[model samples]
Target: MQLSLSDKFHSEMARLCPAPLPSVLAIMVSGGSDSLALMMLAHDWAAEMRQDPDNGPVTLIAITVDHGLRPESAAEAEGVAKIAHDLGVDHVTLQWKWDGVGNLQAAARAARYSLVQEWRRRKRPEIGAILVGHTRDDQAETFLMRLSRGSGVEGLSAMKALPLSHKAADAAGAAPVIRPILWASRADLRAALQARGMGWVDDPSNDNEDYLRVRTRKAMRDLAKIGLDVDTLTRTADHMARASVALWARAADVARDVVTEPYPGILRFDLTRLERIEEETQLRLLAHGVGCLTQAPYRPRLSSLEALAEAAYAGRGATLQGVQSFVQDDALILVRELRAVADYECPADGASAWDGRWRIKGRRLGEAVIRPLGAQSLAALELPKGLPKTAFQSYPALWAGQALVAVPYLAREGLCAPQYDPSAEFHRSILSH
Candidate 1:
């Protein structure tokens, strides 16, 4: 008995989401075959949930981002909205509205995600995860592109089913970005859409050889004549992804043993212990530590990270990715590079993060600027004992004019203190091994 496409999709969704599904699941629809198919399948899934008495009501929201780069973008968004209306699913269109001459693809992607995040924050905060239609074909294309760029295992692994976005870190949100159809092929999705009598817009940019992805896609077609087809490449990516996960688990163990944050925005690792670990594990730990401090979406370049790791292993000081590492008393202290620290102005109400390192909070921070504790700023204070003066400059403090209003880490009186969000390594318990 061959199962229907809808049945296969439902099974995949069950494997991805399982029990206790989110109250709301957002589908990212761009009027493309994959996205439209996802919207239809998501609606069907919601309908199935409604029929179950034990399951609570689940809302399906479709989000479309109009980059406004092309003339037909608005029309495409409207098309998606029409489909959503027909399916009885809530739909919202967001505009990226920007004028710039740069990498259009990267800019549009960032803008799209930013708009989606804003919508989630304001309109549907209950959205547990945002689903994108990234099929195995997309994964194969990504792997081929990354392989051409000389990427390592992590990059060659393509995309994960559930990826953690650092963009959500600043927003203080834990909503993961998921691609439930990563295991499904693009042809399968298009066939499913065809069966449902659905039409999709083929973006002109997809065939533009000016883009690397398009050239790679064309190259992949020829490569398919040989044994290197999309399925084979995607399977290779799956293997690489599994290896990457295992590496991450090992790195987590290494991080637990050697790394510790004595204070906010400061990381200390036992240099002696780190030097003894495998080189690959050392690199992963160092990259993870830097990403934790900066809350960056991606890790630093492998070449740069390797150089930094070598420096750390030799007990020599080095700086990279807005973090400075120096050996101090048998421990490598990685702190926010003061020269690179950006000044963060305090918001009127609610806490604001400073330099992606510290979250500053206070009632009397009206007209005050939050920055690192500097030599001049520290001179004015009576000073606290047993505090590492070298690392003091990286501590976040509140300033009003020339007066140091607060140095929270030092337990300065009547000042606001910043708290560290351990959400970066929040999965340490499971990965600690």
Candidate 2:
């Protein structure tokens, strides 16, 4: 069954943005057929979606990232910009400045998303999501890349249709990224573009076999001879994505049942409940708990996590992934390592992210370093009522030029909340797979 361009476009947009579309949306156009096609389709789809009573007016814009790695990059960005202009959509070309280069692809991707996000924060804060053109071919390539690296199901799931964060910023707040065109094939997009009398610029780097993606692209052609084509790989990735979701759901359920925050910056999982779940889910639950405490972007390596799980299963204690874990009284206690936790500069007023785990807000606290209540602070001062001495060192405290001024969660002096929520962060991790 063949679907028209409009049909595919509308279906993708419907799945990605069902109702209540943002007042403004963005498409990343890299002068590629897939991205250009996405820009064209999204422009029309946004207009159509806006007509619904439940949805509002959507101003679609195109963004071109010029990495400046190659001489033709600027021209390619201009080419995309020209198309965006012809399509009656606003366009902006952002440049990536680099003094020296290593891992060009990764650097470019990070810079591109960072630039786009910065633009959104400055010009269109209403833009909640940015649409990226990641066709099925890209997904297949990603799957192969991860597979070659011995990745697990989560990694094999490849690029998801939506990610909570683009991983563009190290900070707690980052705009969501959506791959609305993942269901479409590159051929379909190019054919649609051709039908519309549109052309695209081919990046030379894509043909450079030195790159993993280029090599994988060529390898996929050979694999297609044996029926291991893009369709097959993409189907495998889709299945893995579903499996990943179920696994995450199970882990989240386990977390809800057993995980408890006995004190600020501390997570305790019931050993009985932890031992009951399957080993895989147990690892996931523990990893997620640690991730929430440390606010690290990625989980510990599966092998490392497995070792930690083994120790936990045996009622033993071990620390991994910036979290210190120990067993005490039928509970697996996990706390952020005071030595490992990064200190964040406290803000004067309003909310500021501390160690990417907690948000602190107060007045006249700017210039202070928010850190864990370490041995020195715990030894020198008195804690609030009902605060246990065992948990005293784990609490977050403000240190201003060696003066311990405030401990928010423990007292009325300041306000603090864990930035990472168990259920929310768990679902976010699944979505990003």
Candidate 3:
């Protein structure tokens, strides 16, 4: 049976945003048909919920990111804003300009999400979820792209509606994001907009064959002639996602037996036990350790991870993905490379994270700052056991200008103490993804 838009949307919302709904929800509107339909459907769903006396008024905010890539972007953003206002939802627009740093499309995507996260943090901390308009089409396209790259289980698994993507930058208090429309097809979305007598801006870049996505989109029809349709790709992605979850759970369990944290940021593994694990589990565990240390959302390259694992098995030491792994004393030690964090610094405001892993907190000296416990800082101090001196160089220390105040992990008589640990994150990340 064909369900009404209200029915379909309400069902998706119930699945994505469970009861006692968030007070504020952010809907990403890019002025495209998919996003426009998402905004309209969200409004209808919110209205349906509000009709029940038991429900409180939910704030629906439409946010448009003006990437400034097209000349029509500003006008399109305003058009979205007008529509949002008509739906009785508050609207805000985020602005971005290419600094010519990297790939324009990739950079634009990362910047868009980062901007929205920052906005939620500073402007609306109450926002419970940021909703995006990724559809079945996006999932299929991403699957093909990853397939071309020879991506394995995790990468091929594609996107999930819940739990903000790990590829996304980590935000402390930001709302969890939901792609509630992933089950919706782009054609269906445009149909909904057409039924409403509404229009959407079509960015010319979508037709530009210079981009890989456009090329992929064009190839979909040819592949479909051979029975490799969107449904086939999406189903394959779903299967991979299911397999991925099981694999992650297995890795988490194995990690408990083989991994330990002698210090906050450092990961130590039982070399003998690690060598006995299945190849898949070994790679998953090593990836988790390196990911936690580097705080990188994406896993290290497959070749690099495999090479490092081979080296560790032979009792050799090498660095990859900002983590230095060496076999020592019957253990495989993974610590942050000293060179990776040499110039890393943040104000000692007690809130700044050092190396994106540890938080160091203590007394506030004049103009205090948090930086690595380099050789110069460790020169006069008595060191601690359980870790090499080179490893300590990347550990955090508090300094007031030139005077050293404390080393959080080392020489902590009256100095500051370690406030965070990456191994905890390693264990937690497996479940969330």
Candidate 4:
């Protein structure tokens, strides 16, 4: 069968990626029509480039992620692997182990990326990029979803052809995700597959009414009643995506100026400077900055951002989504872990505990002990016979010669449980720089 569109797509891929084709390129093939079509296109591109004198050959690896929501998911994965083998492409199946905790979709997404990133790190650390097969229809769906959720320009812009960078450096390393078929439509991809006589597995969940995508897709079909076409939606999404890029670039510039990293996992911002920026810009900058710190793409609620901005302006404290911001002296501290001080059991002498950058020493002293104390300290003078469960839970205890003295700086409460005078030698040892 003649595949004109597939051949054209393969040519486009060559023009986009250029030379030095990565040693190993991963194709996220879910055995669906779109992804399967993408795999075939990529395979053809690799073969053509290998034959060309200008571009060298590249290896293609097909990755199928099994969400395991259905009983046939494992079998589906096997089928995908078989197809990959038939196409002479390496295949790997990443099985999802859902713990049944948080949002199933969100968790599954995270898990999928984690597995792909880990595999790249271990096997092909030098690989330049991973390819995903998100079409124009997918982009339109994303744009509509964000619009329905009251998203800003960035949200509405949806997925990019390039891989999104990690918000924070602590997150997975920087590897660009390349989407080769972003410009292609679902119908076009389906036609390409049909033209090539390629078959794909149909995912039942895609049609299930319970999913937000399914519902939105149904609504989109209904939109056709009003003479709205999928092509129009796709074009609008494309325009919005460009606008989002410009807006995000501006926001990033503002964020770079106001946000500072004084400590690990801690962000500090100048409220006075923030207040001078325009209201919309301020909101966008704050959202972008916080999202960067959290390495999460989903922006916090508008209400949360407003409250945070208000707190920064008023020199108050505000907590949202496990992140806390408080005004301290002249600067605003954005703390990731901001919990009330609690008691902890101290470890014995000649031991240590690591708390971020600090290494705390624990040493028992007959008459004097050195330790860091924050808010939670023993009200009495003498040490209790046994440590309270609360105190023990707060700090990991260390023992030295049958005596407990210091705890990690993070366990400030427990370290000060049996308080000694500041002049004590043991106290000096634990607190010494």
Output the number of the lDDT-best candidate. 3
Q: After superposition, how far is residue 5 of candidate 3 from its true place, in Å?
A: 3.2
Candidate 1 Cα misplacement greater than 4 A, ranges = 163-171, 313-316, 347-351, 360-369, 379-390, 413-417, 424-433
lDDT of 1 by residue, 146-210 (tens): 99989988889868775323234543553677787777778888887888888999999998999
Q: What would you estimate as the lDDT of candidate 2?
A: 0.75
Tens digits of per-residue lDDT, candidate 2, 1-433, equal 9888788878867776666566778888899888998998988787777677888788888989888878888888888888888888999888778757688787788888889989888887777688899899999999999899888877888576764333533454557789988888899889988988999988888899889999999999999999999999999998998898888877766677777776556677788988887888887887777766776757778898888877877987777876777777777778776567545455523356666655655446557656677777677666644233544566677666777767775554643323433332433443333
Predictions in order: lDDT: 0.77, 0.75, 0.83, 0.64
The superposed Cα distance between candidate 2 and the true structure at residue 414, in angstroms, equals: 7.1
- Listed in order, each prediction's TM-score against the native is 0.88, 0.85, 0.93, 0.73
What TM-score quantifies how close candidate 3 is to the native fold?
A: 0.93
Best-performing candidate as measured by TM-score: 3
lDDT by residue for model 3 (1-433), tens: 9997668878888877767777789999999998899999999888888886767778899999999988889999999999999999999999999999989999999999989989998988888889999999999999998898999999999698874333343525456778988888899889989989999988899999999999999999999999889999999999999999999988888988899878777788898898898998999888888888887768898888899888988989999988888788878889888899888888766677777666666664646788777877777877766656666777788877777778765665365655674333666566665
Error of 4 at 266 (Å): 5.3
